[model samples]
Target: MITNLERFKREMEPARQLYTREIQDFSKKYDALGEMSMEEFPDIDTQDYIFSFEKVNGASEEELDEIYIEISNHMEEFSRTHGIEKFCQNARIWL
Candidate 1:
């Protein structure tokens, strides 16, 4: 029988694929901008960040929280290094 974890993973697969594609597109769009500082991209909206994942049917609250935290941390670092606009622009998961 399929486990809960397995089912959850299956449900999240589509969102993950979408996130990857969005990020890649954002990277390409900004590739010509060159290294930009945080101040350069002042329109970044962190309220609805990309890494926020919808809860899977069988996933526990704890599991979803962990996933969000992991993604948030990674995205935070990425935003700091790559600018918040780039981060927000590529954030299609929550969009």
Candidate 2:
């Protein structure tokens, strides 16, 4: 089993072009409403959005696992610090 820290570290690496491609593919899946909605934007997912990381950039299962770990850590830190900007900068999973 992979530890949380290990997974987070992996996700923190630079986002490859493949990742962007996946995002684009995701965008195509939705109709005009989904594509035009404010939720479709942003590198991160928000409550209003239905962002998916399943194949973000065509990442493998291992990569997605790492991304999840990184997201979890970011949430934990942000919750404790209450610093959105700093947390966002620190939590950038796309490097």
Candidate 3:
């Protein structure tokens, strides 16, 4: 059976390609993953996604801040382990 999220997405954006990331291993639980609206017209192969306050849909400020903190931590860790290297492909964002 189709879930509400799946059904809403189908009706709202049938032709759009979506990429999802599971909320995992951030500094804290930060489990704010749900119903994020597409914030930009994607350049599908771009190295990173940019979420903006201007484009925010139903998400709260805390949820956005959680994302920022997790990304900041990831970047700090990445620079420590692998400085300025694009270790993974953009397609892994889909995984």
Error of 3 at 5 (Å): 47
Question: What's the TM-score of every candidate structure?
Answer: 0.36, 0.31, 0.31
lDDT of 1 by residue, 36-83 (tens): 111121122222223323333465666545644554455556555644
* 11-41 per-residue lDDT for model 2 (tens digits): 5323322333334454454232122211222
Highest-TM-score candidate: 1
Clashing pairs in 1: none
User: Candidate 2 — which pairs collide?
Assistant: 18-57, 19-57
Off by over 4 Å in 3: 1-57, 85-95
Model 2, runs deviating above 4 Å: 1-54, 83-95
Scored by CA lDDT, what does every candidate get? 0.42, 0.38, 0.38
Query: Native-vs-model 1 lDDT?
Result: 0.42
- TM-score of model 2 relative to the true fold? 0.31
Collision count for each candidate, in order = 0, 2, 0
